[model samples]
Target chain A: MLIEMLIDLTLACGVVLLSCLSLSAQRVFTAIVLYVSLGLLTTMIWARLNAWDVAIAEAAIGAGLTGALLLVAWRRLCDETAAQPEA
Target chain B: MFTKLEFRKREANRRELPPFAVYALGFVVIVLSVALMFSVVVSGKAAPKLAGLAAEKLEASGVENPVTAVLLNFRSYDTLLEIAVLLIVAIAVLPARSSNAAGVAHFCSADKQDVLNPVLAALLRWLVPLAILVGGYLLWTGAYSPGGAFQAGAVIAGAGVALSLAGRHEFLWHTTAARIVINLGLFVFIAVALSNALLTGTTLQYPVDYAGMLILVVEIAATVSIAAILLLLFTELKAMVDAPREGRQ
Candidate 1:
């Protein structure tokens, strides 16, 4: 019962942190960081829920691959912005 | 003294900060405090029952590995759609122009030279094959082990990246072989699911005797597709790396 409560508390805190980060982050890189952290925390939630398969997929595809993709996109966007001149 | 004071005032006037910083800091502090409180106050004894339930139900699904059962049996349809989504994203995001054809000649001519030290090459010679063997073993044993399609695919892709970096294999940004491999997993997954539905009167339900074979086949296909996708992404990044050089030339 205590373990359950802890898991629930962790999940609730994770969700709140993720939401706050998502709303408060000013930069795209920071947003991606928050998103990936959220993914990791959600994976923990899934593990707590006894869904190890979903947890693994969440960690791998959700956090890892998606983070990579976002970073790549961020780099491309920054490059494009840097190449542009103020009129 | 008046001039110095004026200069100091000017410096202070120029040192402006964003107005949102204070609010953002306050928010962060609040969140951290909440997280601390939860961690301190919450206990850790409520998850075992769920784990036990999962163990019981998953074993009854005829899969020895609970994760495998969850991925391939309990939620097979989701896996099917996930592969489809991956294929769609790969197609939509990858550029139409063939980077392979454009850069192949340059890549081949640049350096046939071995860039690595002989000692590293010898070590990699042993390590690469061993890694491949382990990856294959992981895929084969996924039915009863912690290993699975994604983990094995990542391992194989890591080897591919290493080999390409070592100059053993040319980086092909877009190739027919790659395209085919990328789509083959989704194709096989859909076809198998459809066939199962048609023959068995239920979706994704293989014959009892053929369950292992079907799982293995799907895993192999997923592994290939995943490896192809990752390799392609890396090649695209490499193309970006060479873009500046090409511009200079």
Candidate 2:
């Protein structure tokens, strides 16, 4: 019971820290990376709560696909800025 | 009066709040959130739980997994509407296709470039097929397990995303066949709902004898449609990324 409590505490703290860091990060790429890590932490929390289905969805969609999509979008934005310096 | 006006001008230009104000706002937010969480925790005891009710009728819902039973049977209208929303998003993001001589909407005449990265190519060669297999397994096992159409579809879309990132084979999303596949889930779901309404005089009420089979069929179609829609979102956005570059050149 103590061990489980410790695990839960760690996860909760990690989620709070990552979310704050991600929101405050100056760089968009860094923020996206941190957000993905936050997603992973929540996925683990879901698993610990015995919601296996939610864990899978969070890992696959929330973290993996969302991270990839954000990176691609960031890249696209960067390309646009590079192409149109005045805009 | 002149000094006061200057100070007001400076305040207008300031982009951030004073440190004390920031701290105060943060403190207020924290306190409110904690109070909200406390209320929810205390209220949960008084709230009537649906888990018991869902469990009682799980057998009639036609699936071994309670989650599946609820999502695909008991409250299937929500799922149907969710799929409709997905279809709308898919339609919104679908790339504009330029027609060729065949009169079929084809990929916009964007330049094709092979990925050239041998490692990525080799990785994809193994991973894509494996993803498809896993997606199929998830769909098949959902009736009795934690996996389902959404997870399976997301996995399959991940495979497509991987292929897109590698810049390998071009995915054709504009074809008539692809459109049908993308709409198949919502179409099949609505059809089933109407048929059930006709037979049982109530929509989404599955017959006990064939509930499993009907759920499986719906899941299969949903898996295909979800995968296609997600892949289309990625590919179309990716194409937009390329489109602007081509115009500039």
- lDDT string for model 2 (B1-249, tens) is 111211122335344687788789899999999999999898877644688888898889888898899899988889999999999999888767744436534532222564357887788889999999999998889999899999999999999888777765567777778889899999999999999999999999899999999999999999999988888888877777777778889
Q: How much RMSD separates candidate 1 from the native structure?
A: 10.2
Model 1: runs farther than 4 Å from truth?
Answer: A1-87, B1-18, B21-54, B99-117
Per-residue accuracy of model 1 over B1-249 as CA lDDT, tens digit each: 111211122235436645587578789999999998798678644567755776877645556887777777768888888778877767755655656455344322324564777887897798778867766877777788667887676666656656665655665435556677889888888888888999899989777667777888888998888766765665565456446546856
The CAPRI classification for model 1 reads as incorrect
Worst 10 residues of 1 chain B by lDDT: B1-10
Q: Model 2 TM-score?
A: 0.87
Give the CAPRI class of candidate 2.
medium
* Per-residue alpha-carbon lDDT of candidate 2 for residues A6-26, written as tens digits (9 for 90 to 100): 999999999999999998886
- Itemize residue pairs with steric clashes in candidate 1: A2-B43, A2-B44, A2-B45, A3-B44, A3-B45, A3-B46, A4-B46
lDDT for position B6 in model 2:
16
Best by lDDT: 2
* Every model's TM-score: 0.63, 0.87
